[model samples]
Target: MDTPIRMLENTDEATKQTLENVRKRKEKFDKFERYHNQSIWATIILTSIFLIYLYKTVFTVYSYSFAAMFSAFVNDSNNLTFLVCCVGMYGGMNLLKEKKDKAEKEYHDLRCEIVDRSKDYWKKEDEWKNRHLVFEVMKKQYDINLYHEKK
Candidate 1:
């Protein structure tokens, strides 16, 4: 489900805040990942189109041989501009990938932090509950109230 279920109505505020932060970070990571993939596809499509255009122009006007077409594609001044643009696009895609990686790391770190906090909290709660049970046993067997609060 898209909407989160509130499983624990009495959950501590700190835990709730941590969970909210983790959710936000995960959403950001997902957004970055989507953008990075889109950028990669865009670069691939544009490069393919550019290559097709170059193939038609160079093969028809200059030469039919693969070697000659390759040489013409490399040496042509107008082709240099397209190559530069491709390099620029590649650089931008790399930037998006870097951002996506960073967001992923952040989201994982926050998620782990929340998990650890929950584990620690549950461990302490269990310990306290066990101690409470021991106190009840002592009170019944030894006539001692270990849980008495001092005024």
Candidate 2:
């Protein structure tokens, strides 16, 4: 009777320890998931803004070219205006390109972070699995011991 009582206490303690480990793992995974989602959203927003800027710049350049061609037939004054517009358009395009490059760099960095976090999560999960396996083996041994003693 005393042996059975001690065995029950040990089993309860093991269960408690396992539950605590599972809770910790769940919290860690939740944090990682939130971080990954936020990073992805930020990258998406940045890319969208960059694409919109590129589209606007291209349209402006096209419009300016059309105006410059029409002005060429009208007057010399038109040539100066056309040249200025062309320069402005080119400058705008260059600025947009630089911004796009920066956004891409940020996106790459975020992706690397996500990968690193994912690896960490997997590593932790593996550790938890191994620990659980060990606990199961130990539990089996305990049961076998109890059975033999009873016999």
Candidate 3:
């Protein structure tokens, strides 16, 4: 059976090293979360503005073309093409939004995991420190006795 001192020493070294690694990962995760959120918001706003402009321009043109074609007793195929283009643009924007949402969710999950791991490592490190203090006191008392016995 290993003594308390030996066990404490072993745990102390391992915990300290793991704590450093956890701290680094926590920093990285936080940075990524911030960046991903910013990107998502920017994409949403830009896509909204683009869709509004596209609707205004395409609808106005289609309405004008349809009125002219009706008066002349002619069919307008150009209006159908414009409608298809508008629908395609809307579909593309929706796909991009979904992808961005997924990425943002992933970043959030990663950030939470890093925070939880960091907290666990800190708790273990504190426990190790307390045990090491007790071991040090015991070792000091033993050393003093040996020193006096030599006299």
Candidate 4:
């Protein structure tokens, strides 16, 4: 079957259309690339939030201030402040976990978009290259620069 590139090269008027198509393809490729970058930044932010919350809950909660506060609050081992802190930490952790999960989903979707846009861009680029080759042959045969020549 005759390809779009071959047809486009055969038609003199198609030069304008070809340039427009290339421009659109590049725009599409760039758009997906931008989304991919944004997704990565979102993932980083979500991951950082999760990590910081985890560290505070597990490690930083064992400081001297926390120990002294607990000792002063209650003589018994079970303290209201400790329970409230743990519960609050658990709720905050769950909230962060949900946000991270959503961010991960968005990241995956952006990756797919990038792949799709890349495939389309490369496909069009190949067609453009083939068209150029055809243009080269025509140029040599006719002794004219078909691309930039006056109509």
Task: Give the top-scoring candidate (lDDT).
Answer: 1
| Order of the predicted models by TM-score, top scorer first | 1, 3, 4, 2
RMSD of each: 13.9, 17.7, 16.5, 14.5
| Candidate 1 lDDT by residue in tens digits, 1-151 | 1123123333444654655565666678878999989989988987887788797879887775889888888887878887788888899999999999998788777655544454453356655355445434434543333354220
| Positional deviation of residue 112's Cα in model 2 after best superposition, in angstroms | 30
Question: By lDDT, is 2 or 3 better?
Answer: 3
32-67, model 3: which lDDT tens digit per residue? 556656655665665666556545655555666766
Cα lDDT of model 2 by residue, 1-151, tens digit: 2233234322344343433343343344445555555555555565555445444644454566867544543444634554455555556555555555554444344334423443343345555444444335433533211111121
Off by over 4 Å in 2: 1-11, 63-151
Question: After superposition, which runs of candidate 1 have C-alpha atoms over 4 Å from their true positions?
Answer: 1-8, 64-78, 122-151
Per-prediction tally of clashes:
0, 0, 0, 0
Q: In candidate 1, which residue pairs clash?
A: none
For candidate 2, the per-residue lDDT at 46 reads 53
Query: What TM-score, to 2 decimals, does candidate 3 have?
Result: 0.38
Error at 102, model 4, angstroms: 24
Question: How does candidate 4 fare on TM-score?
Answer: 0.35
Rank ordering of all candidates by lDDT, starting from the highest: 1, 4, 3, 2
Give me candidate 2's TM-score against the actual structure.
Answer: 0.34
